[model samples]
Target chain A: MNEQMTQKPYVIGLDLGGTNSVFGIVDARGDIKATTAIKTGGHTTPESYVDACMEVLLPVIEQVGGLDKIKAMGIGAPNGNYYNGTIEFAPNLPWAHDTVVPLAQMFSERLGGIPVGLTNDANAAAMGEMVYGVARGMKDFIVITLGTGVGSGIVVNGQVVYGHDGFAGELGHVTMVRGAEGRLCGCGRTGCLETYCSATGVARTARELLQNTDRPSLLRELDTESITSLDVSIAAEKGDELAKEIYDFTGKMLGEACADFAAFSSPEAFIFFGGMTKAGELIMKPIREAYEAHVMKPFRGKAQFLVSGLDGASAAVLGASAIGWELK
Target chain B: MNEQMTQKPYVIGLDLGGTNSVFGIVDARGDIKATTAIKTGGHTTPESYVDACMEVLLPVIEQVGGLDKIKAMGIGAPNGNYYNGTIEFAPNLPWAHDTVVPLAQMFSERLGGIPVGLTNDANAAAMGEMVYGVARGMKDFIVITLGTGVGSGIVVNGQVVYGHDGFAGELGHVTMVRGAEGRLCGCGRTGCLETYCSATGVARTARELLQNTDRPSLLRELDTESITSLDVSIAAEKGDELAKEIYDFTGKMLGEACADFAAFSSPEAFIFFGGMTKAGELIMKPIREAYEAHVMKPFRGKAQFLVSGLDGASAAVLGASAIGWELK
Candidate 1:
């Protein structure tokens, strides 16, 4: 793929997830085109996973409209790293922990000659926000995504906190409740913020609220197997007291978590993204109200609350493109 | 000061408060053999303040040790900056406003050989914690001093986060309560973290607790002006329910505040210092318990709760010494 490319420089973006692989062609202005998504081979075999990724990527290149414009490729994985240019053990991916260079090598060979850069999805989101999202002009802010799980990315003094070993901004895992030690989490821990604040968290909370049974609700009519965060959102929007309470509880938790973040980085704002947050004001009102009740003073009127503007499927694509624009 | 002290390589530590000015000779290991405190001369004039500082310093230098051990100096003032080596508009001091090099010039003349470095009290405390306190091994931690007011010194990635403009860590001013705008603070802001979580915050809470009825104990027994944080701590220790409740409330708020911070820098711990923290387990237990109940998950069990081992008067000296050690 690289050998046939022309003189015009172009960039590629890759999003690595548990069930699917996505790649896109982007340019300097952050526009993404020719996006392709392929089923991620279960992480059982590393080589096959690489092959599946290449399968999705090559076609995206052809869709790049004009290959002459492609210059570099940026990969956004669960645990991608910038310094080492490798991904170790990412919990979401089933493959055994290993360096990600082999896959990059494959992509480079398949796509002809081009440079590849990498970073975690959260960091990529942070870069994306700085590059083209709400935090465009601000040097400091944190982005939190509430989806299947809650993921956070921190930007301090205009730069991301990658930690010494590249595991810095793990706010979702910061414990907020007692007995959190044994709670089941994707990271093998219990009571994670993600466990309580993500879409999954909302579902868990709804189940718990339903379990108590002291409170009557229309929720009982839904089939047990299909009740979801969307149902809760809709119910709350319809003024179901139980659903409202769940969102209030969840938003309060998210707000309190953001307040804790304010004390450390003193950023100018918190930008939120993800499907759960799509509940919009349903989740945001509680977060803002709770944040006001708990945030440190300097942070009170200073940090604004923002909802991400990235389109659903397009979110990861832009984040990947932003990674390609690293240090630009 | 900079030129003459090239070879000797020593630093001085000056702590200026509304009540007094302390001068000490600090060496490479953060040791202070000579230290002395003197009146600010109500020091209506900057020259008087400087002269008084030298008089107090010179005698102490001769009495306990000598000038031979000193090299340079670090000043902990209301608004000093090590970056600009200046004190800009110290709010509490008698001087009107915008004081800087004029004060440094006087010190250089008096010390005759040492240079001066400047930073606020909180930053100094953070440095002290990093070099001489429990935070010895951690690259990231927050040192919060719960004194007359709340002040925080933030160290991230092993260094202080001096924002792009040099005024980074201001945790106390972050508002925790919305429209809790009526409480008074030194910075003139209402509902500040300092208003709720400092030594003064304790007294303030006690006052609020005492509003409905007459408490028959130590605090009410003393003249209103004389009521101290120590008195409240004693009452809480003796099982005063109001005092216990006050601490519990504050702890919960602080825990939530810390949870917000967890989202930002993701520090390893938040080390408590200052007289109010002397409440010790009473304060720490609640803080830990509430922090666990409120902080972001990944930060749970990861950031420890502890008190500073450094003492009051000695901390500034040690911190100043650390400044020199770290720099020169």
Candidate 2:
């Protein structure tokens, strides 16, 4: 084991996104030794996609010493199934949208039969936290990614909960508002947590606050149709009341959702990730306050609320890399 | 190992409830060879409680052929913690209400230092289902006990979720109704699922239905304050419209809650246990309908809704006994 660890000191990580597929060769300490990228939709088929990925991935692998020096490969993608090592009907991936793509097996077959694991990006982020980020020593915690849509990776008893169908931890779709008053979600559901707590949800709160009342704020200066979460954060940083209220609303709903999540798993911590977390204590404070106010009495002061520890720019690659260490 | 199994062919199960503490000597196939009971609050202290328990429990041990025949002991009780083998501040237990009682260790010391296991009653019920009932051969499922209070035992990857603090799986306390209009819960919260779905909650619903409208029904003939869930069930069985509507309302809420639960763990099946299940298809049908209607598209029609396969009279004892087989 010691000899093998010394011989193969790195693993290949692929952050497979809608627009770009970033590949990285990483060591045990999470340092990205070599990195490369390819346009994700450039290929029209799964085989062609693997062909393009290998074209760029090979140079990076070679830069870090070759196939023998790499222990495994791990891919993080939308609709990835860890149980099957396949990408199943991912809507944003043109090559994988209508079918199950055996991307992990394809990569392993091309790379001298090295082990490869694949899972959804959110679960990858959780593995990253457990292996190298804020959740390193924690066995039970939830990672909530407040990105384009709300995504969750739930860890219980030191293992990610894959459920019976390998499709557990869909906390984003849990209902917040249960009736006709709820906003429509991308999942074709009404009143999902994603509809109220995602980055888009924050922007929607901004739009609603600006439109619903005559209260004066800096957010009114931006084009209502194109306002983004970053715009809301900047305005809040400048001490705009409406902008601050937007974060309060978003954070409050998130806290309530976390409280409900507590009833399910009673995690020790809730680690926030993605663009909304950049709001810092601006968002976290309200979340903590609301969580304490809404959570059951026994769980009131038990959980720690934290932001992701990984650097923003390379977090995805690191998250994808972390899975490689868990392949066995 | 086979010889040990043959020599110790029985295990002791304790179903410790508020009113009574029932003990049973059980075999591997869930057959009960001997059983006995004592009033749970008969003694004033934990030590004395165990002393009284031993007085009744020893006879059953002798009836099963002697201490050598017993492999282990398992206890199913309120507020039981699997990690520490303690019952932490269980409100219904007079001797344990204000302190953490190390009940499993106490029992182990008395049982000739045999291996012992303890868990919350709902979790024990889940273990029972997995080991010898409907969930046999299944790796993931949720067991919901709808007695006077709604309790849950969640199974993921074939293990009970203990979480970081050993207090996970309090699904009854998850917020179902979000605002002031929601009913008050015993957990000092408003709008908990237990406030609307338990047997008491069903009775409360029946009372409200009786008082809210002048729609004459069989329920009005009885004293409104004295109405029980059994009364509602009997009325529903006799074709009472108001009684049937009460069940529909309760089942619909349960189904909606199950829908939200699906977004969390995505269990392969949800097994319902306890008094409320006697309504059978009247409740289960609406629960299934509401779950499919409210769950995300990917999860629709995927999970099974099941009733406990164990006989109602002995299910609790069997559930407790099943935990004995799991001692490491």
Best by DockQ: 2
Best by lDDT: 2
Grade the docking of candidate 1.
incorrect
The 10-residue segment of model 2 chain B with minimum total lDDT is B1-10
For every candidate, what is the interface RMSD in angstroms? 4.6, 0.8
Please report, in order, the local distance difference test score of every candidate based on alpha carbons: 0.73, 0.91
Q: What's the DockQ of model 1?
A: 0.20
Per-residue CA lDDT of model 2 for A1-328, tens digit only, reads 5656576789888999999999989899898999999999968899999999888888878888888899998898999888899999999888899999999999999999999999888998998899889999999999999999999999998888888888888999999998999999999989999998898998898888888899999988999989999999999999999899889988899999999999989999999989889899889999999999999997889999999998888888889999999887
What would the per-residue lDDT of candidate 1 be over residues A216-297, giving only the tens digit for each residue? Answer: 7777778745689999999888889999999999999889877766656667778898888778899999999988877655
State the displacement of the C-alpha of residue A201, model 2, in Å, after optimal TM-score superposition: 0.8
TM-score of chain A of 1: 0.88
TM-score of each: 0.68, 0.98
Report, to 2 decimal places, the DockQ of model 2.
Answer: 0.85
**On a 0 to 100 scale, what is the lDDT of residue B40 in model 1?**
55
B75-161, model 2: which lDDT tens digit per residue? 999999989989999998899999999999999999899988999999999988988899998888999999999989899889888
Regions of model 2 farther than 4 Å from truth: A1-7, B1-7
What's model 1's lDDT at A59? 65
